[model samples]
Structure formats: C-alpha cells, structure tokens
Target: MAKRQLVPTVRLRRLALELRQLREQAGMSREQVADATGMNRATLYRIEVAQAKPQGRTFQALLEVYRVPEARRKELTAILKSAHQQGWLQNTDDLPSQYAALIGFEAEAMRMLNYESLFVPGLLQTENYARAAIAGSAPDMSAEDVESRVIARMERQARREPPQTLKVVLDEAVLRREVGGPTIMREQLRRLLDDSERPDMTVQVIPFSVGAHPGMTGSFVILQFADEDHEIVYLEASTTDLFLESKGDVYRYRRQFDRLCEQAATPEATRDLIASELSGLK
Candidate 1:
C-alpha cells in the first residue's frame, strides 16, 4: 500500500474513480485482483478508496491486472506523479483545512464559475479590500493572522494556473457594499473592470431588479476539471466548508449557476455598473 495523507487530492480522487471503473470493466472483483496480483485485498481496497496513495509498483500491478492500454497507462501515471505534490496552500498554516482544500480545488480546476452575493470574489479583490474584508469577517483573528490570510489570497490571484477561464456573477449589492472605505472599494471596482477586459474573464451582475435569483441562497464555486469526469461544487461558510461531489448535488449547483448566469447582466452592462459604483465612491 502507498503512504496515506490527511486529505486526498483531486488527482487522487480521479485516479480512484478511474481505477474502480477499470476494475469493473475488466469484470474482476477485488478478491480476484488481489489473488491475481498476489497482493492483499485490504491494500487493494485502500487504493481503490483513496485511503492510500497508489505507489508506482502498486499501479504497475493494477495496469497489468486490468490490461490497460499504453496510452491510458501513461495518463494514469501522470496523475500518480502529480498526486505526490503538495497542495497549493503550502506556506499558509493559518488557513483552515477545509479552506486549504478550496485553494487546492481552485489550483486544479480547468474552469471555474463563481457567484457572490455579498462581496467581490476573493480572486478579484484588491489587497486593501481583502484585508478589510478579512478583518471585518474574522474579528477574532489577530492582526497577524488577518495579514497572513490577505497575503495568501493575493498569492492565489497571482497563480497563473490552468484555470485560464473564469466566469463571475455578482449581485448589485456587492458593488454598493463598503469594504475598507471608499478608496479601497474604488480600487477594487477598477480592478474588476480591468480584469473583465481579459479574453478569458467573464463578469456579470445581477441587479436589484432581478429579484431573488438562484444564488440568493448563498455563494458557491463550480469547479470543472478537464482531466477527469470529476466535478466539485464548493460552498463556503464562516467556519467549515462543503465540497459537494455527488452527481445529484453537483448537478443541482451547476443548474443553479446556469440560472444565475441567465439572470445576470451582460459583461458590457456589468462594466457599466462597476463604473457607476466607482463614480459613487469617494
């Protein structure tokens, strides 16, 4: 069995599902796989459940048992290789485990759909706005802790990773909401306008006229991965967070996001809204 970790990564999650499907496709039970490979059934179970990392030798045996084609073998090997790397929150010990997982999801996602009703999305926040928001939302946090989180958020924005595509839906209230006072909010709105100009960034707004849209319940992020069939719906809270992976749950969130997008103003209209907010700011 390979070594175990506290949290299973996205690659590990996909590898587990793929391996299970491959085993099923081969019409071999775990016992049969264990018997054929001369490995323990417990080890096979652990590997399939992602309780343990699939070591090179272990996957080599698995590919042999399943008779995987060379091309598929290489793909699986790539996932295995990346599974050993650390999560994106390597330096932020102050970050909660669940929040770190959110960062991990963001780092690995091929595309992300985000909807925020209360404030600007973290990825698009200016430094001062982020600092103010964090400080306000987490009053229990020490000044140092707030600064650490602000730095972490800034680092996340700096990551020019595979999520070259991002679509954001914001409520009009977010534009009027005050964080870090007028100067900070003005800069943040300006940044949003600038970011929306990028070819891959799509920004839309749900005005007060929209009246109780699908995202009114709360904010969420839909993460779509190109490498596997795995999709994750992330719901964040003040303390703990939820990662919805079941097909039904993820499907509902995806549908909700689609509805939100439909109700949101166009990108051009959203820029006008931001400009209006900036003008109102001091």
Candidate 2:
C-alpha cells in the first residue's frame, strides 16, 4: 500500500515464504492463483518473492483460494499487516544495499551470535570509538557523511533497549588494535565491560593464546528470530556484504561460531582480561 517496501524486512520475507508455501500446499500454481484472484501473474510473483506487498483484498483472496485454516489465516494476516509498516534503515538509499540489509536483519534478531576477529562488535561500540573508527577507516569521507554513519551506528544500539540477547566472541587483537588511540580504547573497553555485565549480553574474548582458530577467517554474525526457526548468517566486507540463508551456509557458520565460543575465555576471565587491557592503555 505504501509504495510497496523498497527493501522487504525479515518479517515481510518470512510472510512471502509462507505465502508461496501456502499456495503450493493448496496445489495452485501462480497462474491458477492469479486467475482465481484476478491479479496479474507478475504482481503475484512479486508478492511471493517479497518485492511487493499485497493489498488486504488480494491477501484475503489468496487465503480463500488456498483454504487456509482460520487460525493460520489470522496469523498470516497479522504478519501481512505489519510487514508493510516502515522500519529503521529499511529504505536507506544512502547506504550500500548490503549494509542496509544487515540493519534490517539485526533489528529483528531476537538473539545474535557475533564472532569478531578484528574489531569491537559494531552494536557495542561507544560513540567516540565509532567516530574514530569510521573516520580513520575512510579518511576521504566528508565530515557530514562521517557523522551520519556514526549516528546510524549509535541508533543501532536501540535493539538492546530491553537488552537484546547478544553473545559476542572477540579476538584479543580487537582490544589491542588502538582504533582511536589510548583514551578512546579505554572508554571502549569499559563499555564492553559494562555491556558484558548485562543479563542478556554475554561477551567472551579469545585470548592470543588460542592462536589460529576458526574465527581468524573474519567476522560474522548469526541472527535468530523468535518467530522463525531458521537462522541467517551475515558477513560484512570492504567491498560487499553477504547474507546466507541456505541451510548449509547457515550450518557451517553456526559450527564455526560454536567453536569460537568454545575457544573464548569464560565471562569472568573476559572481565579480568578487559581490566588488564584497560590498565595497559598507557
């Protein structure tokens, strides 16, 4: 209804998958459904692929055509209604599509498993630390652009308002990288300590002693939703980011993260290590 979401949210995609499944279960081809609903085949395809949002009438028609159970119909109808609502970073034309897509995924993830080999977890970064990191990494960026990106990074922390369940496995190198120099790094470490204390957050660090582990490959995040059984693996890079929804891809990353977690220091030990790093920031 609202110009059809330019970038479909995870909720929308989930609904889209369900809609396609419902049609299949009902033994109706896209052609048949389009004919029965009197909707264009292309439009129906778009809805199934999550490129467009079906109007209420069209959604109702599809449900009727599929003979969806009363209970499931109400559930799906609720999802359809909410999928069209605007969400943060859902249409950020300024950012790379991959970056924006991660925002959508992160916002909806009820629980996140993040393994970082080079830097502090983005969502856990302090404002000053984030500014330094962004500005330093992209020296050619305009001041306004730098500030805008920093704001977006800060706003992403809202997901932790009720303290989102976040389990972080950070390499020892990230703490010693000195992104914003000593002062900023100290503040960043302190914030990580604070965040680690939160009931919903679990921050574990892989000390340098665990040399050559699986996470040394790079950073990745595994996102899980409350309403969905599947998981999404997100990987960010300098040139392009990736979203892997395939079961094999997801399973491999999940296994990697599991191993990384096993290699990390205990929460109590992590706090001690952070304290040691903070003390060394001379």
Candidate 3:
C-alpha cells in the first residue's frame, strides 16, 4: 500500500528550513533548542525537518533563541502568521498534511479556478451540507469531531473576502449526484446558484451531452495570487496533494481549465439550469 502522506507546500517547507537554520546559527543542538523552547527533542527535529508544526509559542521561543534580526524576524513571523490561519475545515485532522497546506494556500489565494467532476467544492458548501458531506467521508469520526471539522471549513470560507474572479466548471452529474440525500442536495444546488451570482465569482456546468473533453482526469485548482508571477496548479488524491509551480506545468493546467471553461455552459445559462433543477427538487 502507498504510504499515508503529509505534503507540506514550498512555503511551509521553507519556514521549517528557516527555523532549522536559525537553530544552527544560534549554535544550538536539536536537544538544546528543544529544551529552550520547552518542546520535545523529537518535535524539535520534526520542526527542523519540516515534518511537524511547532506551536506558536514554541516557534516564537526558537526565534528569540536565534536572535533573528528585526527585519528577518518580521518576515519569519509573517510565515508563522499563516500557521495561525484557521479555516472552516481545520477542526479535523483527517486531512493529510499535504491537503492541509492546500487549505492555507486557498486562504491566501486571490483568484481561484476549480473544475470539479464530483461533489460540491468546499469553498462553496453550506454549513449543513458541508457537515453532512464531511461526515459521510469519515464515517468513523466521532460526532463532535465531525462538527468541529465542519465548523472549521465553514469558518474558513467566512474568514476571507470571497475570492476575486473565482471561476468553476462543474459537471452536471455533480449537481445530480444527490450527495447528502435529496434535501441536502437541493440545498447544495441552491447554494451554488447563490454563490455564482456574486459579482466576482462565476460558475458554469458542462452538460452530460458534452461527452469527452479536457479534464477527463479528476479535478484541479489553479490559483492566481496577487503577485501575478506566482500562479500555481494544485492536484489532489485520496493520499497525496501536488502543487505544480514550474511555469510550463502551470501553463498546462491553465490551458486545461480554459478548455473546460469553453466546453461548459455560459455562466448565466448554468445558473438557470441550476435554478430549474432546484425547483424540481422541491
């Protein structure tokens, strides 16, 4: 079996490496840093290796020990500020490490495009709908943990101003899938319509009739940051998450998204289709 994976993004890994370097510059051994920060030695090692996350206080203590210069200290702290970001989906640790980094990236994204073949996307899900969906995914989770995870995800959506120029091309089957049963599905569809109408967001559906097209391979999200030069593409699986940052790789996904968007119905038409289906749900 493939190993269970936790893929921290480049940003997180860089932070971890910086922390490790600071410790080394301070002439502190892992055990010594661990003692100074009141963290276990193994944890110190994990933090250095980018395999684990250090708590805020622990992180601050390490910085202090390293005597990070003022400007550099500010920069490191900003990276840690991302660590403090709590999205609506954070309550559950069931998300693999790599996926968690995607959440952080999502929180920071200014523009995002998603092509979903199955299920409603998280950023667009309602509380009841999201909670029910998450519960379905982790049947073994305790009721409380499910609630916590659901609340976190919902809150994540609320924490930021919704994406500027968010675009999604969803398959018609996703609307018809009946995920949390008819009632939840209906609500989910209605919510999709509501979100689509936002001035900066657009949603389109690719009708079942549009047989074979681009994006035949699962789903992908392409995020464009405020810094235009930093665009990225994210691909996820049950066990792993991949971020394509090379210009060539990112352009390939960008092209795929453009093609899928072309094959999808017009935004206004998609909203109308959703509304008609929602009425049928009633």
Candidate 4:
C-alpha cells in the first residue's frame, strides 16, 4: 500500500473521485487498471479513496488509460498538480491532524454554514479574543504555540478576491460570554458587527428566547464545495474532530442549519442585538 497523506485536502479527495469515475466510465475495473498501469491494486484503491496521493506519472497513465479527451485530460492534469501542492495550514506542526484537514476544506469551501453555541466562530474572532479563548481552552500551551494557533485562526478570515459566503448563526450565550474580558469581548462584538456588513457574509443570532432547538447539542459547521456532492459536516471536540461526508449525515446537518436560520433572529435584528451588547459594555 502507498503511504497515506497526513492531511488530505478536499481537492485531493475530489481528484481521487474523478479518477475513479473516469476508470468506471472506461468500463475498466480496479484490477485491470492496476495491472495495466504497473501499480499495486491496493495502491490504486488508496489513490481512489484519497488515502494516498497519486504520483504524477501514475496519474497521467491512468488518465491515458481512461482515454480522457484532450481538453479534459489537461484539466485533470492541472488538478493533479494542485493536489500535490501544500495547503496553507499543512506546514503548521502544532495543529492537530484533524484540524489541519478542516483548514484544508475551509480554504476551498464555496459556502460555510456555522452554528456557534459558545464563543464566536474563529473566523470572525478578533485577535485578542482568539488569544484568550485559545489560552483558556489549553492553558498548558506555550505562549509561542498559542500565538501560532491565534495567527492560524485569524488567517482563516483574510479576505479573498471572491470571498466565500459565510452564514453564521450564533447562540445568544456566545455573545454574552466574556472570553477575553470586557475589553476583548467588546472588540470582538464590534468586529462581528463590522464583518456582518460584507456582501458575502450573513450573521444571525439565535436568542435565548428561542429556547429548545436542534443546535442545543453543540456547534458544527457545514461546508459546501463547488462540487455539491462534496458537502461535509465538521464537528470539533476537545479530544477529536469528526468529519461527516455521508450524504445522509450531511443532509441532516443541512436541514438542521436551515431550521436554525429560521429560528434565529434576522441579520438586521442580530446586528441590533450585538449593538445592544456593545452598548452595555460601554
């Protein structure tokens, strides 16, 4: 078997899927392709599952075997090149393996639906606010490690030319909790107010009055890719991170997010709520 990728990006996974589809379309089985390409069947399987990155020559051979059109071949070849390129977060040694994968997905996600029940979503969090939250969550971390994590988190929010659509639904408690003290929390809230103005972003608050709701379980983010079939649910916990890719699981989370949006305050109303909290801080 081929050595697996430490952290496979969504593009890598998608490329793998495309390879499998091409092989199938050519009416060839894995065994036949493996034999023809002079590669191990197990290695081909790993490539198909995105557990291993395909070698440049192997990828080209498979494309040729599939008899892909010249134009499409060039496209897939380009994707193969990108799949081998390192992701922004791939080099951050301090990041957990699972978290690194999440960053990889977030980097290329076309849309993100995030529900926050505790502190503000990391992407919108102010620097000081993130530092305090990171420190509180992992008090044993060194200052340097903490700063590294903070920088990684803030980098997620850096504006792109065509910004990804971020629709955040925050629990009222998230706004009420003071993660970094009054000053930091105030600044964070103000930052939220500022981010809400972006044309591609939507910020909503699920007030306490909403009472019982599906999101009561915890926070989760649904990431949708340009390829609709690649939607995934990301669940973060103290010990491990869970990535849900099954259609059924993704659908359930998608529906839950839709419901949360319905139950949450409108964007304008959410801004008013934030303003109210900011005023109280002064």
Tens-digit lDDT string for candidate 3 (230-251): 6767776655556666668778
Q: Which digits, one per residue and each the tens of the lDDT, describe model 4 over residues 1-282?
A: 996434555557657777886888899999999889898999999898777889888988998888889987886777677774532222234245445456666776889999999989999898999999999988988999899888888777773325578899999999999888899999999999999888989999999988999999999999887743567788877765566666687799999999999999999999999999999984
lDDT of 1 by residue, 125-236 (tens): 9999999999998888899989988888998888845436899999999999988888888889999999989887899999999897888899998888775666777777
Task: Candidate 3: list runs displaced more than 4 Å.
Answer: 1-9, 12-62, 65-100
Q: How close is candidate 2 to the true structure, as a TM-score?
A: 0.70
TM-score of each: 0.70, 0.70, 0.68, 0.70
TM-score of 1: 0.70
Off by over 4 Å in 1: 1-11, 14-95
lDDT of each: 0.82, 0.82, 0.76, 0.82
lDDT of 1: 0.82
Output the better candidate (2/3) by TM-score. Answer: 2
Model 4: per-residue Cα lDDT at residue 223: 85
Residue pair clashes in candidate 1: none
* Backbone clash count, each prediction separately: 0, 0, 6, 0
> What are the per-residue Cα lDDT tens digits for candidate 2 across 74-122?
8788778788553322333325443545776676678999998888988
Please list the residue runs of candidate 2 whose C-alpha ends up more than 4 Å from where it truly belongs after superposition. Answer: 1-97
As a TM-score, model 4 comes out at 0.70
